[model samples]
Target: MTRKPSGQRGPVDHERRDQIIAAAHEHFRLYGYKKTTVADLAKAIGLSTAYLYKFFESKKAIGEAICSLCHDTLLSDIQAIVKDNITPSEKLRKIFQSLAHNGAELFLHDRKMHDIVASAIEEKWHAAIAFDQELSSIIRNLLLEGRERGEFERKTPIDETCRAIVLSLQPIRHPALLEYNLETLDNDATMIANLVLRSLAP
Candidate 1:
């Protein structure tokens, strides 16, 4: 939210903010995130650029909001997998496979939306930061559960192991790198998960 100098209008209208984001998502899909402008979004949504700024500080902020929404949807899918009544090892494998599958799907099929996320990640937007942190927590929790159940080794520090696992998956998980390894992404994801599981075995 932006600060009003003095005597602004009514409260920060969330309805209007949502309207802007909805319009932006469509326009961005059509025009690509790099080419779309804030003025273009405002004109499409029947709002003034200045008015839009009241809800979002800048064009990137609007993108961040959309990115966050997308991340939430993806996170929901991950959380579902985490909660499934399956072995921790299976959960770990499925999680990595899902991440690779989704990343490839977005990059190969939804290139426009993928660009928005690529920008967010490359720019280190708050949406990307928050998503990464939440994802790390999820992975850490899964590791802890596996260790508690005697499915994984407890000798290594869990934090270090979690960090290594995430780093190992970056090539498949990252948008920009997804294209380069599409041919072998699935195999690589499986291999990485297997290696991690083997390392974690009690």
Candidate 2:
């Protein structure tokens, strides 16, 4: 029987890689990134540490994969909101609310997970930066739509306006800020939406 070439992964290898990532997520959630080790993750998935390393380079890599999964899920949710058939103003409001609501639920619910997220941001992980850029682009697209639909009067360049909108709503959109005062996200979202809308009025 012929064996697969070295470094070539088959279907089973992919499945095992996914299983390791899933198990690592749970371990990170329960034990936090700093405390979780490759051995713990490998044992949870019924694999030896050396075998797990064939899938992930290190425990940090596993943590990064978990973080990427979360960011991808968030981007999907925001993309859905952006695609909905609704007025730009309403979409903006919903987007603000969703950012705060979902971020708080994901990070604030578990202190260990929150710490992991904080560290990711501090380290400027590639996934985290990509997530932020995508979100900013979504906001930019919404602003352009508002301008095209005659819902907003231009006071500045569209790009600048979009940046301002994102910066202005940072308290409700930034995970760290949201974590600091989650209880007021709902009220703050409403107020910020109204203020932004009024500023954009013709």
Candidate 3:
């Protein structure tokens, strides 16, 4: 939640923060990180840079906010897919569907998202890898669990399987792969997710 320095607003500060994030998401999706500037974002959000400053110190902060939102959404979707006490195969199928259903919109709308994230790799590598690592850990642990549960093939190393899932996700970084393989980015998401899930399933 963000508080007005003047203490003038009498509402939940979280709402105001969400509004800022909405604006950031729109602007960044359109102009991307390198092309986006503080002044433009401030103007679009109908606030002065000084006021915006009170909430976000820099463009990178906005990028971080965007990344955080995407990461949370991805995790939530994955969690929902696995929330029920279903079989491993069903969990894998749902994971693919969830990622495919919503993930394509993310890449199509903001093609520059990966670049913005990649640029931050050197400085914020840990933060940048947090989502993938967490998801990979989940995959690895699940595979181990699945093996013990007699629900999966007992062949490849768990780490290797997890790495494959994460690497399949990396195809989004390729412009041609994103554009050509499927009719649209959204279509691509489902196709890729399906393939990944199959690779892990028996």
lDDT of 3 at 150: 79
Per-prediction TM-score:
0.91, 0.84, 0.68
Best by lDDT: 1
lDDT of each: 0.85, 0.76, 0.65
Global lDDT of model 3: 0.65
Model 3, range 86-154, lDDT digits (tens) per residue? 876667656655655454555556577655555555456334567666777777777787788877777
Off by over 4 Å in 2: 1-13
lDDT of 1 by residue, 1-202 (tens): 6522122234545566667778899889888989978899889888898888777777888888788878888899899999999988998899899999999988888788899999999999888888899889998999999989999999999899999888877988899887899999999999989988898899
Indicate the TM-score of model 2. Answer: 0.84
Q: Native-vs-model 2 lDDT?
A: 0.76
Candidate 3 regions with alpha-carbon error over 4 angstroms: 1-15, 29-32, 107-127, 172-176, 184-202
Q: Quote the RMSD, in angstroms, for model 1.
A: 4.1
Residue 191 miss distance in model 2 (angstroms): 1.3
